[model samples]
Target: MRRSRLTVVGNAVALPLLLAVLWWVASADSESIYFPSLQKILGAFPETWLDDGWGSSIIVDGVPSVARLAIGFASAALIAVALGTAIGLHPRLRAFVEPILELVRAIPGPVLVPVVSLFAGIGDGMKVAVITLGALWPILLNTIDGVRGVDPVMTETARSYHLSRPRRLIALVLPAASPQIFAGMRQGLSVGIILMVISEMFAATNGLGFSVVQFQRNFALPEMWTGIIVLGTLGLLASLVLQFAETRVLRWYTGLRAADHES
Candidate 1:
């Protein structure tokens, strides 16, 4: 157990450590106007993002971005899971809606940014809408697939016991389909982050994305790099949090898989 824990820790830190070393070495003496040294970017970070009292750029920019992402992703996940359950359990409904779902999914998410902006205007509403719509597809489709993939035997057993629809879904179907649902959620999360940035790029007063663009336009390369680094850090943290949640949520599934392998 100790060895396993150590391995996990090492795996988590190895890549970041290596990348930090590489970045430090490679950009140590960089003179290019476009590519500032990592040190310079790090130095600029405090000044640009952290120095202002309660109104620091990081708080102003990062907080709203994170809030929009949370609201959008949460709304998307809840709606997708509920709707997918309905569609997945009904063959006729699935067949009727499949084509339209595919067509809508085919339209690249970012392409909707301008249209959403036009209708919703550039506000929190537009940003959240863009993110929710963009990230909805993966979770929705994966949930449908997961629900459909549940074993027929399990469904029969639930029916034999006279389980209510909601009870069956909660106790049987959801547990069985959780892994796939989680996979979809992770994909949706990544998509949400990308859309969050993209949505803010066009008509936004404050956000990491807006700040990045502002820095670039002003030729503040180091500050721009800081924004990029912040985005990367946010993505990594979000992924780690999701992974931990998934492990907890699917612990029973994981235990069963392990038992099967042992047997």
Candidate 2:
């Protein structure tokens, strides 16, 4: 534990130092290049915030992005888990659907951006659909892996005990499958964040992505840098939160391993 903590602290220290060096290198030649310095970007943040009406209209800008992400990711999760579970639990269903899944997963998410934009016309719905489509593959694929990987012993035990279908799923399968489910969720989340920004950048009038494009087009280099930094920070923060949640929720499985190691 102490070693792990030290390793974490080391990485935390190292990352900032590396970033600072990169920032300095970029700043020195910033006049010739499109890159802005860390300091300049930091300085621009408040002004950008103010100009965007962060006090009153932050919601107008931010809410749309957040709401779209939430809706799209939730929809993706529901459909992916449902369909993946069905496929995983039944060999026949897998045989029927795997080909279709393979084809859909083969297509890049951004390729659909034009199609979505054409039909939906830069609306929130289009953005949400893009996010959902982009995120669905990872979740669905991971879920299929998880469900199929559930312990056969547990399944047999449930059957021997005459467990009902719902009971078997809830008691015997879900707990066993939770780790994989969480893994899928993590993949989905990362992909969803990417698609969210992409959709906004290409299609929406208001979002962090839009903010980046707006600043870049206006040649506000510092503000553009600030937006990019914020987007990266948001993605990092969100991933971190999900990781923490996963740790908390899967304490039992993790703790069991820890206990075994101690023994």
Kindly report the root-mean-square deviation of model 2 from the true structure over all alpha carbons.
3.1
Off by over 4 Å in 1: 1-10, 53-56
Residue 123 miss distance in model 1 (angstroms): 0.7
**Which digits, one per residue and each the tens of the lDDT, describe model 1 over residues 1-263?**
46754686578668987998899999999999799899988988888888852233878999999999999999999999999888998999999999999899889889989999999988999999999998899999999999999999989999999999999999999888889999999999999999999999998998888888888888888888989999998988788778778877988988899999999
lDDT of each: 0.90, 0.79
Which of the numbered candidates is closest to the native, going by highest lDDT? 1
List, residue by residue over 103-186, the lDDT tens digit for candidate 2. 999898888788988988888888999989888898899888888999888899889999999998877676777788888888
TM-score of every candidate relative to the true structure: 0.95, 0.87
- Global fold similarity of model 2 (TM-score): 0.87
Clashes of each: 0, 0
Identify the runs in model 2 with alpha carbons over 4 angstroms from their true place: 1-30, 50-58
